[model samples]
Target: MDFMPIFCDLKEKLCLVVGGGQIASHKAELLSRAQARLTIVAPTFNHRLLELGKNANVSLVQEAFSEHWLTGCWLVIAATDDPVINQSIYHCATQRQIFCNVVDDPLQTSFITPALIDHSPIIIALSTGGNAPTLSGLLRQEIESHLSTASLDPLSTLATLAGSLRQRVKNYFPAVHIKHQFWLKFFTDKMLINAVEHHDTLAINVHIQRLLTESGAVSLNENRSN
Candidate 1:
């Protein structure tokens, strides 16, 4: 892969945007959603950007782009209309060892933002290495549609429940292989599937407990044999 895909936890991290237009606003909004402390620097800004600046986590600097703005920033987006300014921002960020994205100029960017599908605890990101954003968006739509029409419960709900039961599963299984086996069976079990489909948390918990009990007994027997 040309670009390694990874999700970042930007909660309270500093991020800088070097424009106040629509594209810059969009990038700022995404960072804000990630709970980043966002600072936008621009001589002029559009209405959307002005509105986003009202948020507690976002700050707007009505001044020309400068290298000083990049100080302590974990990520930077160069969204200025001027190519020279954007290039300068990218170079400055590079010197600071920060990941910088030059909007619409992937070749100059250290990172490219992917189209995201947020299902809360289950986010899916689609990217084309910044080669074809439109195609990436289309693929994302198709996947979202498929997920919505899937026979099973919403993946987010299933993921949330799985997270809540993770500690319990670990405590019950102890052995890594045994824990993996329990999850594999839990996901594929007909009883669990039926309960998830109907949103019956009680039934789901009961099924999980039964599976844990069975697996624990097997594990105990295996240990005794060993």
Candidate 2:
């Protein structure tokens, strides 16, 4: 039951999805969003899937999946409703040691797809170990509301500020405890909330300035202690 958790970089990587139904299409859409170069294999495609292929950056192989189809793919998803077809895909992927997720069939999968909420640089994934996908999905939706658009802006601005501060005050390393404490407060402070809530660039900028001043103080104290 032990499994390794890792995120795959699918951008420009070969990915295969063996189905054209709604579940198959859903998996394909997620892969496409990750910039994966996808090839979908199915005897037929739904109307929406066909339209999506026409404009989307993907390939369509219209035929039943053969054992050879698993060749050269970085990851594969067996989302077809047919258990027989899914079993074939699982065995093929297992033989090749390629990661594969078979929807609703945990025992046959090498990986599990979690419910994800993506806000560009910020991604939250929820997993129920393939027990209740619907519940996980609902939980993800609930968690999404708490992460406001503004919550991310301060973090982005903080990154830029941190880079400049690092260069401005070079050749000094604060004590690990002090450094950790300073950043913990900086990131989790009310200033971030205010910056996000008001959407005021000025407020966010001020928050960054305060954080820089605090870091400077900590650095000066550390030097004095030494």
Candidate 3:
């Protein structure tokens, strides 16, 4: 089967994990970091899981999984070592039309969570479609070495500022074509990339204006040449 790519926003959304073992604990940690309202259901939880749940403010349900436990969740994860239990959780989630993932059981899952690198405001996700998780993890490590803490803050700030500029452009122009050209010009400009890579906020701001001005100049030159 061909691999599919999906990106999700889980902020403040209710997410369920039907296990308390190491696998479930790992998933719970990622969900919590994504700001998902996480709920873990199992008869017992590991101490590490318990401590993380307490610290990261996740709800732990020390009970068996039931249909009632699957109510109103945006997404569900089945991470138990017990295949039968995981299958049950997957079935329940599917019956309710909610998104479900069965860890290490790709065929039974509606979605697969990728190996993630979270640099605040910048997120990188790597996946191998369940074919090779270890390989995926190794690739993630390689990617981490190339990314630094210094790059994210500036990149995110520039992205936000770019959005603000696009919004202002839309308010004035109100044309999809013009808005698209603005984005194309914004992204293709070398100065924007240079400024962001070097974490130069002032240079980024200056380059943004220069790019816009240069785009306008080119447009006018084309009109006159015609």
By lDDT, the best candidate is 1
User: What lDDT score is found at residue 109 in candidate 3?
Assistant: 93
Task: Give the alpha carbon lDDT tens digit for every residue of 23-103 in model 1.
Answer: 998999899989999999999999999999899999999999988888899999999999999999999999999999999
Q: Count the backbone clashes (under 3 Å) in each candidate.
A: 0, 0, 0
Candidate 2 local lDDT, 17-95, one digit each (tens)? 9999999988998998899989899999987578668756788889999878888999999988899999899999989
User: What TM-scores do the predictions have?
Assistant: 0.89, 0.80, 0.80
Every model's Cα RMSD, please? 2.1, 3.5, 3.2
- The digit string of per-residue lDDT tens for model 3 on 131-180 reads 78899999999988887767566666666777678666666445466557
Candidate 2 versus the native: TM-score? 0.80
- The whole-model C-alpha lDDT of candidate 3 against the native structure comes to 0.82
Error of 1 at 74 (Å): 0.8
Error of 2 at 54 (Å): 3.2
Candidate 3, RMSD to the unseen true structure = 3.2
